[model samples]
Target: MNPPNVQYISECFIKPKSSADEDETKQPIIHLAPWDVAMLSSHYIQKGLLFVKPSSMNDQENTVQPLLEKLKESLSLTLAHFYPLAGRLATSKQESPPHYSVYIDNNNSPGARFIHAAVNLTVSDILSPVDVPLVVQSFFDHDRAINHDGHTLSLLSIQVTQLIDGIFIGCSINHVVVDGTSYWHFFNAWSDIFMTNNSSISRPPPVLNRYSHVLNLPFTHHDQFVGRYEAPPLRERIFHLSAESVAKLKGKANGECQTNRISSLQSVSALIWRCITRTRRLPYDQETSCRMAVNNRTRIEPPLPEGYFGNSLQIVRGIAKAGELLEQGLGWAAWRLREAVANHTDKAVREWMEEWLQKPFTYQLGRFFDPCSVMVGSSPRFEMFGNEFGMGRAVAIRSGYANKFDGKVTTYPGYEGGGSMDLEVCLLPESMRDLESDREFMDAVCI
Candidate 1:
């Protein structure tokens, strides 16, 4: 399969609308919490590509010279409110605790990288869901080009790729700055501005105070989590589960418990966990864990504001023996997954934060090679199809990161909608081969 040819037209930084403070020597350096600092060692950046149909000439009197022009203009205006996206993460060379903070030095650093490019392809070609990695790579630069050596920095990167009958909005955001929720918030905000042709619409102002939620960690724990773990070679495959299949899975998961009802997320995650374990042929007694990304917006005490940005995420893991999860049925695994999610309450989040402050980076520091662990990310709640920019809503959406870790799962809303889900599953080549031929897994997935 040949990769799509994407021609890079131009690359320039989109500065904020107001550059009056560019000459100011003293700038704000937003402090980061322990959770934010932990990601620095992992060096994981979030990348996604959104595909929108071609704009109808009648939609906007066709007055907007080009879509890229409007996008850049609106993005400049949008960055005024979300300025952190325009900044970089860095540390002042202090003798004591390296002051790691978001540097908003306007004179020294440009806001975000915006690339204008085009591809010779159609919307249908992308929506087909084949050659996904090739298409994704052509549009987005997941290289994390920004130097993260704590000395040099660049935070966000945006690339607007134009197709024959569509447009692709590619974004690469540093994981230290924002999580999934904040990622979509900035995206939707950009779309809203472009749609309404008004930068002053009723949008939730972003909360930039990184110190608001502090995780005071000990200085000694700084070196505790340092080494970056290498992952095994993996392949990415997208599995679509129809709404009917999801309902059946949910029903089966709930059947195990007479009292508690299992959620769609829990049911779907449990099925993936079981399928991966069985496909890998892991020993029956071998312990495996499913780490689900939990948003702490509502789980935090008093709850964060409506548009509080930053990394407000925590991964909750559900552990069980490989044989136990595969043998016990979907309900049993779902029950365990449900309990893991339920345990992330307001108090639990606070306690977890404090506990993390003690050990800090011990969790993800050197565990990338753990084949027994599956990291489930993304949520159907953030429906990418509903994201309507000035031209049109996104027909297909995908992440650009080549998830190197084995057993990593990312979920998105399927084309059929109505609770249907598309799981972008990544695993070792051998395990993926087994999973592709697994009868039970195939029966549950909608072809």
Candidate 2:
């Protein structure tokens, strides 16, 4: 049998013909800045679901229908203020971080937005237990395009099944329009507003107002980045952390280190670092970094408002010499990693953010971040994991975003009482083999 096919379908969208002399006209929504279009397109490549059984769901949710209405209304009102970056995706020429417009076919009465391609995910649990259903989903093919005919753009298709329970909705909002804090607030508000009527999402607070629009700001400053930088190459691989291993690493080893403040994530991260350093054969004291991402919604001074959107993020990096990281005890390694992450909310971080926004290459810098870096951060913080229709608590959740960097790890907690952690690590496959071989590191890991 032939291997599974990665399907693709493309269609052209033209703006409504404005006059007899012209065949078609592209809609204004398609003219959004290329930088802005990317903010909307990157969400597609991030994470594929490991659908866990949900506790509950309403089959008749018609969730998308209601959402469509809200989005339309929001777009109209939102476009008035954000036309520079709203409507369809933009089409830019860069590929490391791809960019394209969301074409529109205005010929349709509703001015359907034209997408160049569409991906159909056929969901079936044919190979799984009879009780499970194969839940197919579609991934719109609009990663890169040009001359976005907003009039041709169409609705993004989404489908859910009763057999599956939890979902990991990872979004890649343009940094130009939102930061981490702003994005989550928008997410929280989007959920709240959509879940019920009369639910108002407050406007995002004023965090980053720095914009050059031009290559030159008031006073321009540029510097070379210190760390090794690479782009995150896409691939398919399961981030494996077996149940038995995690338990032993987390403390199944000895009775002495029992009853501690260490969470599974912290313990696992430390072990991962030590094992990685050992596997890589790096000398002690060599400056290596472990980075993690932290959401700043609740951390902003005066607190940002509910609907704030834009890039509000902090890269917490832990650093220690190869010798210190590997030779030191687990507690020492964990502490070093934690301290490196301590900068998650320093005043300097905000200054760095403001400085970055003032940069013309902010997007370019984002594109340069590889997945193989020796840093890790827990993401898709699901504070509201209670939004399930049926099935049961999610058995696991994971993220497989391994950019070109060295050590990339993320942890997602299961639903209440969902015992094991769903840890996702995307590293060079060869390096992973070495990680698995480190018995000392594995023993220190507390799952």
Per-residue CA lDDT of candidate 2, range 1-447, in tens? 322333333323222212333323223333222233223322322222334423233333343234334534443333222222233333233344443223221233332232221122222331232211112222223222112222233322112212222332322233334444443444444444444433233444333222223222222221221122244432212233454555555562122344455545555677767777777777565677666665554555755454433444556666777777766676666665555555455475567656654652322325545332465554434432433212233343322221224465555544443334444554565666666567875453343
Among these predictions, the greatest TM-score belongs to 1
Per-residue lDDT, model 1, residue 263, is 95
Candidate 1 TM-score to native: 0.88
Each candidate's root-mean-square deviation in Å? 3.9, 9.8
What is model 1's C-alpha RMSD?
3.9
lDDT string for model 1 (285-356, tens) is 899999899998888878989788778888898999998888888888888889999988998888977777
Ten consecutive residues with minimal summed lDDT in candidate 2?
A: 130-139
What global local distance difference test value does model 2 have? Answer: 0.40
For model 2, the superposed segments whose C-alpha errors exceed 4 Å read 1-3, 6-172, 179-265, 296-303, 343-346, 353-372, 384-405, 415-420, 440-447
lDDT of 1 at 179: 78
